[model samples]
Target: MKAISYSRYGGPEVLEFGERPDPKVGPDKVLVQVRAAAVNPVDWKAQAGYLDTIFDTVFPVIPGWDVSGVIVQPGVSVTEFSVGDEVMGYVREDVLCHGTFAEYVAAPVRTLARKPRNLGFEESAALPLAGLTAYQALHRALHLRSGDTLLVHAASGAVGSMAVQIARHLGARVIGASRDEGQDRVRELGAEPVPYGDGFTARVRELAPRGVDAALDTVGGQVLKDSAALLAPDGRLASIADGEVIALGGRYYWVRPDTDDLTALAGLVEGGALTVRVAASFPLERAADAQRANMEGGLHGKVVVTVDHDH
Candidate 1:
């Protein structure tokens, strides 16, 4: 099968499009014909060796985790899904090879969920990782509840956008912080927009004088610090981007592949409580370009790589 891979850790320049061996299906896995895969910053960061200490890298690694595809074959022990099932997953394995940026992937059942019936493959592909991250952070780590006031940093980006919508669905009053250009989008996502940069904390304070009831930080460094300060006393805080959040009395979260969580996100999508915005897409062969596009930042939604089986 043709796939995008890199034999060594490097930038987009190291990625190559070529034929690679098809994955072997395990008893708890299914072989999926790839329809679309979403690019996350972690994809390129893992390719660049930033996560080497945390995840073992197999040489010539395929570099994607979020997928929306159809099941071509289910493993011998699989019973949850069968051939022809359309699914989406955050297909991160314990290791760093055999990823979704290929014609096919052998995805474990734990990572799979039925795709939202209301969305296309590209939008479904965009939902898993970012959606899971936001869902886990807001629902699990922060324990956000109705009537609570929540502040989401980077509120117009992929995960942050999901956070805003999910928080609103949970009946929270959302205050979203973004750049000036993304403020309108943040507001559209049901958050009161607060611009970042100078006076960011002050701006948030003006909206919630007692500080917010909870704060989610998608941007690290100074932004994380500001988020901590903006939290109301006894407020919950979580950060997917910075471990330093722990030092400031917040949980540092890493998204996990959980079928239950993905299913919940699909529920939100089908119910019209959640929507995915796809900012850009590239063919599978141009996955390196997709990675570069995601790395360039300033995108309000996901950058996706679509697979064409017709060719």
Candidate 2:
């Protein structure tokens, strides 16, 4: 099968489009015919060897985690899904090897969930990783509840956008922070827009006045610092991007693969409570370009790579 891969850790220049051995279907995993795969910042970071200490990397690595595809075959031990099932998943594993950037992926059942009925392959592909990050941060880390006033940093980006919507669905009053250009979209997602940077904490405090009940930070550095300051005394805070959050008595989040959570997110999408926006879509051969776009930042939504099966 033709796919994009790199034999060594480097930038997008190392990525090459070529034929690779098809992934093997193991017990408890399913072989999916990839229709679309979404690019995450982590994809480029890992390719650049930024995560070498965290996750094992094998040579000729296929770099992607989020996928929306159809099952072509299920492993002997797989029972949750069968051939022909349409699914989306965050396919991260302990080791980086076979991945969703290819024409096919052997995905473990633990990460697989039925794709939201309301979405197409491209939209579904964008949800798993970013959506799960927001869902877990708000629901698990923050324990957000109805009537709570929540603050979400980088609210117009992929995860933050999802966080805003999910917080609203949980009945929280959301305050979403972004740059001046992003404020309009943040407000559209049901959050009171707060401009990011320098006086970010002050802006959020102005919106909540009494203080925010919880905060989720998707941008690191000063964003997390301000989020920590804006929290109410009893407020909870979590950051997926900021490792220093722990020093501030806040939780640092790394999204885990959870089929149950993915299923719940699908329910939200089906109910019109969540939406996945695609900033751009590239053909699989152009995976290098997709990663470049994600690294360039400032995207309102996900960048997806579409695989043409007949190619």
Best by TM-score: 1
lDDT of 1 by residue, 59-162 (tens): 88999999999999999999999999999999999999889999999999999999999999999999999999999999889999999999998899999999
| CA RMSD of all predictions | 0.7, 0.9
Off by over 4 Å in 2: none
In candidate 1, stretches whose alpha carbon ends up further than 4 angstroms from where it belongs are: none
For candidate 2, lDDT tens digit of each residue in 100-132?
899999999999899999899999999999999
Give, for candidate 1, the lowest lDDT window spanning 10 residues. 195-204
Against the unseen true structure, what C-alpha lDDT does each candidate score?
A: 0.95, 0.91
Clash counts for all predictions? 0, 0
